[model samples]
Target: MEWDWNFVRQIMPALVEGVKITILASVLGSILAAIVGLAIALARRSPHRLVSRSVGWFAEFIRGTPLLVQLYFIFYVLPDIGILLPPLVAGVIGLGLHYGTYTAEVYRAGIDNVPRGQWEAAKACNLSARQTWTHVIIPQAIPPMIPALANYFISMFKETPLLSAITVLELMNQAKIVANTYYRYLEPITLVGAFFLAISLIAVVLLRWLEQRYGRMEP
Candidate 1:
């Protein structure tokens, strides 16, 4: 079938609305993942062997599994145990947790890259552990990690389409609905691809800027 401008116009509002949800999920999920990843990274570095090993093993399990399976468990399986979440909440949790394992590795590497002298200096100054991490380690660590974190955010944005499986009305799901309603696959599907491509390219440009701004400052 031929491309139809009128049909495109009709579907644009719905698709735009879907894009908002897609971006919201990605942003919130990224924030949650960063927090979770930082916690996991810190836990794995605990002085206690049991705490460290347990967190390490749990992170590995999350990393080893497929995100789709995780999403299904959160959305479908949880209610069986008397826990229930909205579709969007379940999707956000799934994305955050699945990616948090990977981000934990990024955090580990960033933290490790800090010069050992910095830790020694903090100790020499009699800085408490809290003061040392807050004033020295994380500030130095996070700048270099921004590009990697941004990369994951872009990846999470793309993965938002997977939320469709759980009935979250993200871009791909909205496109699918439009296509089904009109029995026209070309326009809505093509539009979805176009939107994703545009956003991803923009994100890439921003990531490059971040790398240039922060990467060279690394010691």
Candidate 2:
């Protein structure tokens, strides 16, 4: 089909809403992933063998499974057990949980890279465990993790379309709706690609800025 500027214009409004929801999902999901990942990383480092092994296995389980399957399980299966969530909430949780496993590795690696002396120093200083982590370890570990975590953020943003499976009106879903409804795939599909490309470029710029800003270890 020939490109239809008018049809593009008509769909712009819907696409705008899609962009908003997509951004919202990405932001919320990234925040949750960061928090969950840290928790998993720390738990997997517990002194108790049972706790550490169980948490490690759980993280591996999540990391090994496909994200789509997890999303389906959360959105569709959970409701069968008296747990119901809004589609956006379900999608955010799925994205966060699925990606959190991967981020957990980043967290673990970052923490490990902190020199053993740092931990020894914290102990020598009589710093509480929480204070050591909060005041010393995490601050230092996080700088190097920025690039990896930002990469995951972009990946999660790209996968926002998967949210459509649970009825999220993200950009791709909106595009699909427009295409299916009007029987014109060219304009809407192309628009979707263009929109994604634009956002991705912007995200790249932001990632670079973050890298420059926080991707360094202080002397």
Candidate 3:
């Protein structure tokens, strides 16, 4: 079928709304993933064997599962247990949690890469664990981790389409609705691909900048 500029104009508004929701979900979900991942990484490093082992198992379980299944449970199954989250909220949590496990691995690797001498020095200085973490380890570890974390967040942004399965109405969902309604698959689907391509290109550039900036470690 021929492309219809008129039809494109008509659907731009709805698609724009979808774009907003998509960005909102990606941003919120990325923030949550970062926080949750850091917590999981720290928990896994706990001195207590039970706490560390249990947390490690939980993170592994989350990483092992499909995000689509996790989304279903968050949006559908949780309501059965009186945990009735709105569609968008559930989608954000689902994205956050599923990706948080992966991000936890990134955090774990970043933290582990810190020099053993740094830990020894902190101990020599009589620094408390909190002070050592806050002042030294995090400062060193986080810089190198920034690029990896950004890459994961970018992947999460691309995965926003999965939110449609849970009825969150992101870009892919909007495109599908438009296609089904007008029975014209070309315009909407193509436009969604263009939008994602443009955004991914921009993200790649930003990722390069992050790699140049924070990817370098200071001695």
**Candidate 3 lDDT over residue span 174-203, tens digit each:** 999999998999999999998889988999
Q: Which tens-of-lDDT digit does each residue in 176-215 have in candidate 1? A: 9999998999999999999999999999999999999987
Model 3: lDDT of residue 53: 97
Per-residue CA lDDT of model 2 for 149-181, tens digit only, reads 999989999999999999988888999998899
**Candidate 3: TM-score?**
0.97
Which model is ahead, 1 or 2, in terms of lDDT?
1
Comparing 1 with 2 on TM-score, the higher-scoring candidate is 1
Give the clash total for candidate 1.
0
Best-performing candidate as measured by TM-score: 1
The numbered model that scores best in lDDT is 1
**Backbone clash total, candidate 2:** 0
Candidate closer to the true structure by lDDT (higher is better), 2 or 3: 3
Alpha-carbon lDDT, every model: 0.94, 0.92, 0.92
lDDT, residue 21, candidate 3: 92
Which pairs in model 1 have colliding backbones?
A: none
TM-score of each: 0.98, 0.96, 0.97
